[model samples]
Target: MSDWTPAEMPRLDDATVVVTGANSGLGYEGTREFARRGATVVMACRSVERAETAAAELRESTSATLELDVRECDLASLDSVETFADGLAADYDGVDVLCNNAGVMAIPRGETEDGFETQFGVNHLGHFALTGRLFPLLVAADGIDGDARVVTQSSGAHETGEMDFSDLNWERSYGKWKAYGRSKLANLLFAYELQRRLDAADDDLGVRSVACHPGYADTNLQLRTAAESGNPLLKLGMRAANAVLGQDAATGAEPMLYAATADVDGGAYVEPGGLMNMRGHPTVGRSNDASYDRDDARRLWEYSTEATSVEFPL
Candidate 1:
């Protein structure tokens, strides 16, 4: 799959893809490709109005028959996650793909509606609950010519992440980057554990849980972090770095698209195949050793299930 691009993706005429944070960045780029290739893409965003606006833009530019379903899903709130899943269940019989793409980068410490740290809550816990709630639908979609896939978007930062179960919420203190890394590490932990569980169940459920990362994409994620940090020098530095080293959203989204549609293995981590894993086409990249620790993943899973109350049917 060297130099693989969106042009290489297969047509998804009957697929249903739910992409969180679909209004911007890599999510938007992935949604555009899915819809253009004939999938019914659900734009799951925190703001319905903004999602509608992005949908409108996609419709005007994409295929006339593009089925872009706009839905509101605030990942910072557990109730919102349940509501979104409930609504989708009522309308769609199955989901071919679930793209856990919505996330927050390095930002000021805060709390979600559920009392968890903002980054961990939205980036890991929210997606954890959403995937658990949607497990039935994912199982139902299995064996329909192919398997249903869950693409959890992780990052290169996971290498530096250390799970602090004692202070999961950063109640004592918080380092923005550290918290972000932990959450991203949790993403991989959850993704791999889900696949392991599915295999152990052996119930013939063909739902593949994979992970991916966009290598230094020049998206609003960095800009928003810069603006939110409110440091002139930091903002200037981010802008200069983005201008010099970042790739476009389209290029950054290739790994996600590949993981979602290509013949990838379960628990595989897709990433850019360039030097330092920063800028290139989609490839099956590897995560740090900590990400593959079953003990940590199980502990995180138990804690998340207790916190979110969304149990997996596996």
Candidate 2:
């Protein structure tokens, strides 16, 4: 498949886009690009101050004819996700694009504010709850617009993951990277299953679920995870690696932007088109066989719904 570049993206003037974890890194860069293309950009971030600062920077730099709204939402907490969804539903009649972009990686095993494993809670369940709660607004947007898109961020590390239902929370043994891999794998499975449900229901809600990965981009998430693990050597190595092969966060955002706006089929998984999925341009990539298992996807969907207590109308 041919790779996609930021310059090739379609004009997003009429789209109302929400990007979770929009304070920095790929999320912030994605927000900037959408705003630059004239989409009303909502920065849903855990840090209100940081999000506001980033929004202000975008406003100062771009002459794009779109407004930016920064809202606070901590994906690690279901209550916070609910509040954010509630506020969005109350304030806006519709949302055209929902980008589940914020995520944590390789952090020390720990609990969230809600006492769930941090990786699963924030990376999968949180977005699951948020998307479920916001489905109505998404449908509303589809009623007005021709299409509405939901983009979930997965990772290449998903290839190394296997879901352990018996120890989903890493209760028996918590390995930082493994848990993170499981969470990311869950992301791809969720996207695939969601699209399948939408198709089966023949829903014309104009909502399609897609997944993308920002292949080895230089982002603050890596630094934060390394700091949490107290691994200076790993951090140093990552920094050096990034300096050599990592692309800018703007480049990293290309796959997501393409998935959200490009004329692509539903259920496509996008990633950077470079050597070994490191960094470059955006293209449709292959998902692991495990990620495409219908049985596993359904089981995970059921488990996630039970865990997050958010019911989908499917």
Candidate 3:
């Protein structure tokens, strides 16, 4: 990790940062830190009530010198994703940073509202569609101190995943962790591809896509998954890991915070700088070798466009 801490983060007095899943965990931590640095924050979440409560708590704890708006957005629903995009476009000409941080972890097999496998749909397609819908505004926005960024949250699990397009929805078989890995891998591929397209676009657009991972954070994400998975052994194992190996959510949020706010190139992957990357400070990182496959990324992009029906204006 770099020597950069939240205290050294750049001020964003005129910036707007949109964070999905802002109701809890790293999303909430990122929102709080961004707001603390004077950025107008849009807390996009699945539940409005939870979002409102989180916003209130954020306000109470942090001395924000800017604004915060909590908007409802269910990533599993295409309608909700479009609605959230429409609302943001109507309210703001553009936003400085878009943090695609909302996602599902290892959980029981399920389907999204649009019938996509739960993990692939919410973790990959949801953000893909959201970014496509919001691209115009992203291209229009002036990055607070550098270039506008679409910071997608990826994970270490991606190292073990591959783009099984034939089984993209995991219809024939399923493993929660494998599904989770596939989604994270897709996240990296999408970020890299988006950055490639932006790099080829008009320089005036001043937009780029980057990615990061939170490392092993003891957030409700895992606990929730285990509880809902109906597997006592899985639940117990996860609980044990949380108690012994997990870092606090705030520490885990550092890499993402750095990736979103620091002056960095598109396609860069930020991760925790410590032993096995489980806990440490923010640092410039790299994804697995598979994540760098241009052909895979392009194919995934095309398929995602077809899947989500939201095309980028590149």
Q: After superposition, how far is residue 1 of candidate 1 from its true place, in Å?
A: 8.3
Ranking by TM-score: 1, 3, 2
lDDT of 3 by residue, 212-288 (tens): 99889999999889888788997899889988999999888888889888877888999988889878887887889
Candidate lDDT values, in order: 0.92, 0.88, 0.90
Best by TM-score: 1
- 1-314, model 1: which lDDT tens digit per residue? 46799998888888899999999999999999998888999999999999999888888885567899999999999999999999999999999999999999999999999899999999999999999988888888842248999999999999879998999999999999999999999999999999999889957687999999999999989988988899988888898998999999999999999999998899999999987898999899899999999999999999999999999988
The segments of candidate 1 whose C-alpha lies over 4 angstroms from its true place after superposition are 142-145
TM-score of each: 0.98, 0.96, 0.97
Clashes of 2: 0
Candidate 2 per-residue C-alpha lDDT over 261-280 given as tens digits, one digit per residue, 9 for 90 to 100: 88777899988888787677
> In terms of lDDT, which candidate is stronger, 1 or 3?
1
Q: Who wins the lDDT comparison?
A: 1
Q: Which stretches of candidate 3 lie over 4 Å from their true place?
A: none
**Each candidate's clash count:** 0, 0, 1
